[model samples]
Target: CQELPLIPEQDSRDIEVVCNLYESLLTLQRQGINGIWARIIKNAFAPLFNKEFDYVAGNPPWVNWESLPENYRQDTKPLWQEHGLFPHGGMDTILGKGKKDISMLMTYVAMDKYLKKGGKLGFLITQSVFKTAGAGQGFRRFRLGSGEHIQVQHVDDMVELQPFEGASNRTSVV
Candidate 1:
């Protein structure tokens, strides 16, 4: 058996590489490991907005509002309100649970507040972003330029996973 080098031990400074490492760590943590690096970085940088990222990639956690941790749920309320995704009672309903898709909302927030005009954003998002009434309307109404809006590129179907493998029946890379 051969030993695989740890990600942090690698020398490349590519942001995509860093984000990939973060995603892997996050996946491991969700599986019950003590991986805390990604959460730490996200928390530290959540408040700091960057002009743009050269490369962004990940299968964002699809946790619904009801499943979100208290702190994050509280912190993200304003974003939900600003984006018009907040439900009544400030809580998620069974049908609405996970349906709000904070990942998509966060992506919009990042692009609106951080990405430079004409800058590109590459991320994996649920197909609902393209089909959901609210999200679809929002995307259609989104303005990237004076009279322009965001566009979608190469799309792919869902991959199988546990705990809800096919729950994302319409998953796509957008």
Candidate 2:
């Protein structure tokens, strides 16, 4: 498929559109031997099925904290706090510390839930996540709870390459 329809939550219209697109693609015999082996999960953070893999990779959404829906923010606030991604309080919150991209949380959750020991994960995330002082401090800490830590093996800065069309955000592969 040229593109996978991304509906963060269940929406009948979106699902129908995706199904129709798939059907059209399948009619053209585009699918391989495995056919269309895909699971459109309702939620990535709280997945219904669970499994650990040796490797995981993704380009999580780059929504800022203020852009998130109020309900969603409220619901996931506990998880963010538990993961130490949420800002402490007072000056931290006022200064927008740890309130930048949601991708950081997504990265944390993906590694915490899906990756096995000795596993490696690659994520294409905003470069500001590393350079900003207050924004990604928690993420830079590299702690994954229960005394577990992730060793960042590599980082490839792609800011100068301008790989994406019509996108100005600085990106990096980690």
Candidate 3:
């Protein structure tokens, strides 16, 4: 199971999905939340807790090493280390050096579980993949190493205009 701690960016969506989906928060408002609701809510979002798919999609978290919270950094250090994404977790932010981004990790790691031979994958990702060689090296490496098992189907360059309002960084569909 993916033990995703409620990081800063996902709190709103996580809370909404957890509480609103089953009206558990509504029940809490009238009767006060109880252990049963908590358990039910956790079970209610089982799909979020556990993931395995043939065609994984959607935007994963974009937090890079420098922007990540200290607690999250601590929690994912071992995983990053094992993947060779964040060696020592210190040199990641240096210029021209490969840095760790959650989205980069998800691109391939998801393949290990959700995608396998003959499976396809896609994501709406940041344009950092094109703008910076180092920022997107992990993702590049994943595709490169996948050999003939993975092939580039399409890449929608959304950089002509920003997709997210107020987001300076452009996005892409790949």
Candidate 4:
């Protein structure tokens, strides 16, 4: 058997499950986290709940801010500011540069709220996040406050491979 990191304080309730409940449960079991129905809420919804993890992984949906539901956009505005995902200048907004993918926020939240110091986060997301000058500018800053920096260790570009069926958007694992 493989040795799993001992999460003494992390229990079944600590595993946040947004979708794919069955799959998440099975993965939790395989990772040595007891699966439970309690605390089955989106991490975005529970901003106060903070539990650190040695590693975090996810494929956050790649929806732009303008495409998100109006209510969701309003509800998460504070969170965006809290994590500094939004730029400070109103010029970015006027130039259409303020638009950002929801996945960027997910990445920031995962690292800021859930990841331990020096922990690793891997996410399958739109490759434009690195190249786009509009919405991705904020993400490229790579700063998490107080001089903390997100050092990207590696990137696997899957754009040419077209791994997703019927989807043409450029993708990458970072």
Indicate which candidate wins on TM-score: 2
What C-alpha lDDT does candidate 1 achieve relative to the native structure? 0.58
By TM-score, the candidates rank as 2, 4, 3, 1
Question: In candidate 2, what are the lDDT values of residues 80-170, reduced to their tens digit?
Answer: 7767776457788786665668898889988898899999999999998889878888788888865588899999999989778799999
Model 3: per-residue Cα lDDT over 18-71, one tens digit each: 446546656765785442553465467656648565677878767676676566
Ten residues in a row with the worst lDDT in model 1?
1-10
Residue 84 error for model 2, in Å?
Answer: 1.2
Greater lDDT among 2 and 4 belongs to 4
Listing every candidate in turn, what is its Cα RMSD in Å to the true structure after a full C-alpha superposition?
A: 7.0, 9.9, 9.7, 9.0
lDDT per residue, candidate 1, 1-174, as tens digits?
012344544544444555666677678778875434536667656765445654455566555556666666777677666654543332434344335666666666766666666666766666776676543444435543234566655566544432345463556666
TM-score of each: 0.54, 0.73, 0.60, 0.69
Lowest summed-lDDT stretch of 10 residues in model 4? 11-20
* Candidate order (lDDT): 4, 2, 3, 1
Q: Where is model 2 more than 4 Å wrong at Cα? A: 1-40, 43-49
**Backbone clashes in model 1:** 0
Assess the local accuracy of residue 18 in candidate 3 as a C-alpha lDDT between 0 and 100.
49
The whole-model lDDT of each prediction reads: 0.58, 0.76, 0.62, 0.77
